[model samples]
Target: MLVFVTGGVRSGKSDFAERRAISLLKENGSNLHYIATNQVYDKEMQERVKRHQQTREKSGANWIVWEQPRKIDELFSHFKKDDVLLLDCVTTLVSNELFSGWETNSEKWKNVVFQFEIEQNLKCLFSQLAGAPWHVVIVSNEVSYDGFASDEGTKVYKRLLGRLHQHIVLLAKEAIMVECGLPCWKKGGIRT
Candidate 1:
């Protein structure tokens, strides 16, 4: 089953998803895999990553962690069908791809190559997940409220993330939006 979880920044979406994953792992009797998609770019980010790692370690689950900051679609060869993979935060993965593709371009909206890269990479990862016979949980940020981006690159990134969310939500068996540490189920029930 595919589950999609989204919420504002630091809105407890990751914690909710991890708890659901723990229950699913216990019920399904499957191996737990945490696919961390974030990377530390500075000292502050390094500390944040350290804290997250510590939290995961203290969660009292035997989670096999994989750090895949990019090319997530190519990681299917590393696990089995019975593995329960929880990919925490698609926002960082998409941002990393956006930066990598946008760095070589001039105008953000007019860059066809960057657009193609983002579309292809996201689609590749989603399709790979679709074919995998495992319980998958995807976490993303919901930041498209005001519908206004200050810059062209931010605009492009927001639009890309919105589209990615729509696609994944459709592919998911369950969709949830976390607000202030509470989850409002949008598609399926909260039960595992």
Candidate 2:
């Protein structure tokens, strides 16, 4: 099963997804896996990562954490049937994959090839997850409402993220948007 969760920053989407993953794990007697896509580059990010770690630790679930910021498909072989896997967020994954080789000011930012490549990579990863027997929960940020940034790079990032979110929601069995720590279901029922 593929589930999609999205919300603005500090909107509790990650916490919701983590709870869902743990529930699925307990229900199916499966392994809990956390694929953290955030690349901690500073003190703020480091603290955020620490908090997430602390939360999972307090949950009493043995979560196998994979700090994968790019090339998520590489971890496919490590997962097993019926396991619950939660991908913390897609926004950082896309940013990491998109800017890995190109500078923000480079003309390549305008090229459609980079976007296409990212879309293809994510598609491949999702396809593999769907084919497997595992349950996957994908979390992403809803950045479209963030006031318009006039920069070309920011524009391209937003466009790509929007497209990815649409594609993910379409493939997901359940789609949810978290606002003020409340989950609003956009697709599927509220599974107990």
Candidate 3:
């Protein structure tokens, strides 16, 4: 089963996703896996990562964590049947994929190519997960509400993320948007 969870920053989306994953694990007695996509580039980011790790530890569940900022499709073989995999956030994955070796002076066509590559990579990963028996919970940030940015790069990022969210929701059995620590179901019934 595939689930998509999204919300604004600090909207308790991660906490919700974690609780859902733990619930799935308890029900099936499967191995719990966490695919963290954030790269700590500053002190605040480091603290955020640390806090997430601590939260998982405090849950009293054995979680096998994988720090994968890119090439998520490569991890398909490592997961076993009935395993519960939670990808913390897709925003960081998109940022890492979009900006790794980015050329500020590149032409518009180059940006298109970058977006295509990121989309293809995600598609491949999702395809592999769809065929597997694992219960996948994908978490992402909802940033389109801030309105389209004036900068070209920011615009492209927002557009790409919006497209990705739509695609995932279509594929997911459940799609939820969390606000003020409350989950609003957009697709499928609320599991929790």
The candidate scoring highest on TM-score is 2
Error of 3 at 60 (Å): 0.6
Clash tally for model 3: 0
Ranking by lDDT: 2, 3, 1
lDDT of 3 by residue, 1-192 (tens): 888999999999999999989988988847999999998889999999999999999999999999998888788888888999999788988887877765464444246876798877877677667567999999999998787599887888888888888888888888999999999999996644
Q: Estimate each model's TM-score.
A: 0.90, 0.93, 0.92
Q: Write the per-residue lDDT of candidate 2 for residues 1-192, one digit (tens) a residue.
A: 988989999999999999989887888837889999998889999999999999999999999999999999889889888999999889998888777765445555466886787778877777777667999999999888799979988888898888888888878889999998999899995742
Q: For model 3, name the residue pairs that clash.
A: none
On the 0 to 100 scale, the lDDT of residue 65 in model 2 is 99
- List of clashing residue pairs for candidate 2: none
Off by over 4 Å in 1: 101-110
Highest lDDT model number = 2
Candidate 1 worst ten-residue window by lDDT: 101-110
Report model 1's TM-score to 2 decimal places.
Answer: 0.90
* Tens-digit lDDT track of model 1 for 110-189: 58786777877797688678668888999999879656888977888888888889999888888999989998999988
